[model samples]
Target: MPEADGAGEQVGVGPWSGGSPPDDPRYDPELLAHGDRRNVVDRYRYWTVEAIRADLDARRPPDRHLHVAIENWAHDLNIGSVVRTANAFNAAGVHIVGRRRWNRRGAMVTDRYLHLHHHPDPAAFAAWAAHADDGARLPVVGVDNVPGSVPLEGRELPARCVLLLGQESSGLTPEAQAACDVVVHITQHGSTRSLNAGAAAAVAMHSWALQHA
Candidate 1:
C-alpha cells in the first residue's frame, strides 16, 4: 500500500477493487484480494498486466501504425519519458538506436506496455524501417531544430512514418541526420532554444495523431 500524503490521499495510488474477485480470467487473483494500485485505466483495474496488454493488442486500431525512434548514445534520461509518451499515443513501437540500455526512471513504468526494438547503430535502424516486414517502408522523419529544417506545422506527415529524435544535448548526429528522408522542426515563440527531447517527441506524436490517427 502507498503512504498517505499530507492531505490524507494515497500517493501514486490507483482505483481499488470491491469485495469479491471478478469471475473473469483477466482479473488477477492477488490484485482482487489486495486492491489494485497499478497505474492503469478503470477497465483494467484488478486485471493482470499481460491481460491488459493482450486486450490493447487485440483492439489496436487499424492504420494506427506510427513508429518512434530515439538516439540513445548518451543513455539519455529523456528516453524513458519519450517511451511513456509513446505509450500514451499508442505508437506501433519504439526504436532505440545506439545503446540498448537507457534510464527508465522517467517512464513511470509505462515501458512495460510499449513494444521496444533496439539497434546498435542508426544505419541498422534506418534499414529496418526501410524494409519492415509489413513493407510499409515508412518515411524516416527527423525532429530537430537544426537550420534549414522545415516547420512541422501544416506539413502533412506520412500516414505510416517514423519520427526519429536525437539526444537532448547533442541533437542529431550526422549519421542520424543523413538517414532522415525529411527533417522537420517544431515552431517555438518562447525564449528557450528548444524543448526537451521527450517533450518534443510528445508534441510530434500528437501532431501525427491529429493528422493520421
Candidate 2:
C-alpha cells in the first residue's frame, strides 16, 4: 500500500508485501524490494525502464503515431519540456537537430522512456525523414508564427508527420524553413508576440492529436 503524507495525499507504493513475489518479468526485483517513487503512472510503478518502454511501443498506433523534432543549436531550455510533453502524447520519436547534447532537467527524466534521435543539421534531419524505415514520406510541418504560415487551429495535420520546431531566440532557420513542406502558426490574441517554445509545442501536439490521434 502507498503511504500518505501529512496532507493525506498518497505518495508512492511501499515494497512488495505479499507472501511470494509475482512471476511477471516486467516487474523489477530491485524496485519490488524497494519502494518505487519515480514519477510514472500507476501501471508502471514497479516496472523496469526497458519494460515500460516496450509497453509504450506496443501501445503506439502504427499508422497514426506522431513525431516531434526540435532544433537544439542554442541549447534551449525549452527542449526538455517539449520532450516531456512528447512523452505524455506518446510521440513515435523525437529528433534533435543541430546539437546532440541538451539540458534534460526539465524533462523530469521522461526521455528515458522515449526514442530519441540525433541529426547534425536540418538537412540531415530532412534527409532521414525522407527515407525513414517506415517508408511513408512524412511531411515536415514547421510550427512558427512566421509570414505565409497558415493558422494551426483548424488545420488538418497529417495522420503521420513530424512537427518541427525552431530555437527560442530566432524562429526557424532558412534551411529548416526550406525543408518544411508547410508551415503553420498558432493564432495568438494576446499582447505577446509569440509563445514559449514548450507551450507552443504542447498546443501544436494537442492540435495534431485532436485531428488524428
Candidate 3:
C-alpha cells in the first residue's frame, strides 16, 4: 500500500516494468507501459478504464439492490467521499439530489467507475423509487440521528432500497425526512452528536451489504 505524504496525499506508483505486454484485450496499453496505481484492486491493474467498467457491469449481480443517495444542497465536500465509498461497495449507483456539481477531489477519481444519477430534488428521487419495476416498492432509507429515528443495529434493511444521507452541517431536510420510508440512526458511543454525511453513508451502505450483499 502507498503511504500518504505529509499533506495526506498518496504518492502514485509508476508504470510496470521487467515484462512484455500481455495479449489480453482488457489491459490498457498505456497503463501497462506506465504502471497502474489507480485506487482499483489488483485484478483491475493496467486495465483500460472502459474495459474495467464493462467487466464490472457484466459481472455485477443482477440483484444489486443497495443504492446510495446524498442530499447535495450545499455543494457538500462529503459528497465525494460518499461516492468513493459507494464505489468501494459496488453499489448499484449514486444519486445526487440538488446541486449537480460537487467537489470530486475526495472521490480520488473513483466516480469514473461508478454509476451516478442526478435529481433536481428529493421529490423527484422519491418518485423514481416509488415506481421501480421491482415487485416490491424500493424503500428510501434515511440515515441520521434526528428525533424519532430507529436504531440502525439489527434493523432489516431492505434488499431493494436506497440509503439516503444528508449534508455535512445540517442533517436531512424536513422534506427529505418526510420522503423516507423509515429513518434510522447509527448508535454512537462517543461525544460527537453525529457522524459526517460521508461516514454515515458508508456505514449505512455496509449495513445493507451485510444483510443482503
Best by TM-score: 2
Model 1 poorest 10 in a row by lDDT? 10-19
- For 1-213, candidate 2 gives per-residue lDDT tens digits of 343444657566778898787889999998899877676889998898999999999998888889999999897999999999999999989999998999987887789999999999999999998977477588899999988899998788988899999998798888999889999999999999999999999999999988877
lDDT: the better of candidates 1 and 2: 2
* Cα misplacement distance, residue 82 of candidate 2 (Å): 0.4
Q: What lDDT does the true structure give each of the candidates?
A: 0.83, 0.89, 0.83
Taking all chains together, each candidate's TM-score versus the true structure is 0.89, 0.93, 0.89
Residue 181 accuracy (lDDT) in model 1: 94
Q: What is the C-alpha lDDT profile of model 3 across 1-213, one tens digit per residue?
A: 333444777555567775767888988787777667677777887888788888777765766667888999886889889998988888777899988898998887888888889999989988878876364567899999999999999999887788889989998999999999999999999999988888888888888888887
Clashing pairs in 2: none
lDDT at 101, model 2 = 97
Model 3, C-alpha of 211: deviation from truth (Å) = 1.6
What C-alpha lDDT, on a 0 to 100 scale, does residue 53 get in candidate 3? 80
Weakest ten-residue segment in model 3 by summed lDDT: 1-10
Name the runs in model 1 displaced over 4 angstroms: 1-19
| RMSD for each of the candidates | 2.9, 3.3, 2.8
Instruction: Compute the lDDT of residue 62 as modeled in candidate 1.
Output: 55
- Give the winner by lDDT: 2
